[model samples]
Structures are given as structure tokens and as C-alpha cells.
Target: MTLTQRQAAYEAEVLRRWQDQSDGAHDLGHLRRVWRNCQTIALAEGGADTEVLLAAAFFHDLVNLPKNHPERAQASRLSARAAVDWLATQGFPAEKLPAVEHAIAAHSFSAAIPPETTEARILQDADRLEALGALGIARMFYVAGAMGGALFDADDPLASHRPLDDRAFALDHIEVKLLPLVHAMQTTEGRRMAEEGADWLMSFRSRLLREIG
Candidate 1:
């Protein structure tokens, strides 16, 4: 199948599986963006397998768990297993399954598994990109609201005098996790993109603080 055909098939499967999921942050659009980011990073970095990256990107969030779930850290591992099993049934290349699984499994920040392959690193970087910039801001607040968290600390929005608590304030998540992701990007291209996205996040935060004050 052509790359476009394969992408459409994968997306269809993902949508079928996620039909009941209520988390808008991890929806089909998010998966498509991750795949696009993977392709961009892979093109700049080179040597990544497109097929592996495509499968990994589409299936990375197969087992989407809530941020506050007790097994949130295991979601990526579970997703990898589920993805491999489903792909195996669909006649995907067996030799490439390990790479796809590793990419999906290592893509999660909470899982903390290191990406050992180029595809894995690209997937990790691509997924992390979703947690920055304009889209990141929207997802951050959406997730915070889903978890019953506040928008920001009224008096200490930037956490100057107090410790950052993302659970208590959605704005604190940019400092606690999003900004740090720029340095955490595995590929050089990914880092460059992440830096831009992080800068945008910072600008948004500045605007938000100014408005609140």
C-alpha cells in the first residue's frame, strides 16, 4: 500500500478503537499531528523507518489513560502491546513490529522508558511536541478541567515565591513539564521545533499573567 493509504487505514483503526474515549486531547487529530511531526523530524534527522514511525505514531495512545489514573505510567507499555497484537493480526511486517512497539512504548513521558532506536526517538520527540505551543495550551487547560484543576494560582501564576503545582493550576504545567520538554527532545530537529514551541508557550503565559493582573 502507498504511504497515504496506509495512513488512512491506520487512522481508521485508531478512530474505531477510540470511539468511546472522552478525552479530546488524545483524539484522532492529535494522532495525525504526531504523525506529521514524526515525518518532519525524520526528514531532517534521516535514517528513520517511515512504516515504523507511522504505526508507532498512530498507536502510541491506543490505551489512553487519564493523567490522574493510577496506572498512567503503564499506558504506553499497554498501548505498545495492544498495537503490536492488532498489527500482527493485520499482517504488518513482523520484523518491524519490535521497532514500532519500542517507539510507542518509549513515547510517553510518564513511562520514562528511553528510546533506543531512531524511530523510537522520533516518535518520542513528535509526541512531546504535542505538549507545547498553541495546541499544547489548549490540551493543558482541557486536561486540567477534566481533572478538576484550576486555571492558575491567582496571586502566584508564575510560581515565583511558591513551588509549581500543575495539579492545582493548569498554567503551572508549562513550567513543570512543557518548558522542560524542549531540552528533553531527542533529535536535533525535534529540539529546534520544541524550542520554537516552548517560546510560544512562554509568550502565551506572559500574556495570560498580564491579563490576570
Candidate 2:
């Protein structure tokens, strides 16, 4: 099959896999959101191989479970191995294997998938971007909602460490996760986008606080 054909098949198969998941945190919807964000980053960054970029984005979080779970599920790596193997057969040259693996491995925040290649870094940035702004708010709330009752009642731990259930984690995410994305982004372009997004989150969170007070 052609590279395009392989990509389409891979994407459709992953979507099916995502839909079959009952997981709240790493659902198919999360995959779609991250993939979209990746496309945005890939366009801005340019120069990196597009096929490697998209495949990395699409498969980044395949085996993510609870944040507290082990760094990489053996299963996660295996799943990636399988995907990589399939890609190899589909005209993805052997030389490109590492690039695909690099991007796929580094795509996960959970996996400690260090983004060595520019492609991997762009894919990582793409995944990170989804967790900010209005998209971020909705995404957090979605996970918070699925995680159970605590995500709502849970307050930001920076204010006070109140045992940090799902709720507390969500709150800490504001200051720890969302607030610092601007600095965490690697590329200047990524950082610039993150800065604007961070401001949006800050202002929106402020509104929520004022209304509650």
C-alpha cells in the first residue's frame, strides 16, 4: 500500500481502538484533540517529515492509564512496536524507523519519551497544547468529570494541599501544568503560541474564582 493508504488505515484503526476504550483520561476524544493540536504545530514548525509527525501524534498515548501508573506499560511499548513493524512493511524505509519510534516514544508526557528529534519535539508540543485554553478547560473537566466527584470539589493545591484527589490534581494543573506551558515549549513558535494560550487560561480561571467568591 502507499504511504497515504497506510496512514489512513492506521488512523482509522486507532480511532476504533480509542472508541473501544472506557478509559476516562486517555480516551479516543483525547487522541483526536491531541492529533489536531499536532497538526497545528507541524504546520507552524514545518521541515519535519509530515508522515512521521502525524503517526507520532496519532499514537502517542495509546496505553496511558492513570497518571500514577508506571512510566510505560510494557504493553504500550509493545503496541508501538507492533505499529512500527507494520509501518516498516508499508514502504516506511528502515532508516526512518528510529524517527518514527523517536516521535512515538517521545509523544507521551507519561512515558518520559524524550523528544530528541525535531519531529518528536513538535509532536510533544502538539500533545501539550491541547491541555490549555478553552480546549484545556473542557479537556480537564472531561477527565475530572470521568474520574469522579472529586474533580469538581477538588481545589487547587497551591492554595492548600487538601489530599489531592482527582479534584486537587485538576486544580494543581492550573498553576503547575497550564501556567508554565509557555516556558516548557521548546520552539520559539511553540512558546509564542503557549504564551497567548496561557494568558487565556489565567484570565478564564480568574473569572471562575471571582464568580465563586
Q: Score every model by TM-score.
A: 0.97, 0.80
Query: Each prediction's Cα lDDT score?
Result: 0.93, 0.67
Per-residue CA lDDT of model 1 for 9-63, tens digit only, reads 8889888888878888998899999999999999999999999999999999998
Displacement of residue 210 (Cα, Å) in model 2 is 1.2
Local error of candidate 2 at 175, Å? 1.1
lDDT of 2 by residue, 132-213 (tens): 7778787777666665534434244346645434454565567756777777786666777777788888898778777656
Model 1: residues >4 Å from true position, as ranges? Answer: none
After superposition on all CA atoms, how large is the RMSD of candidate 2?
A: 3.2
Off by more than 4 A, model 2: 1-4, 16-19, 23-29, 70-79, 149-169
Candidate whose lDDT is highest: 1
| Candidate 1 colliding pairs, count | 0
Q: In candidate 1, which residue pairs clash?
A: none
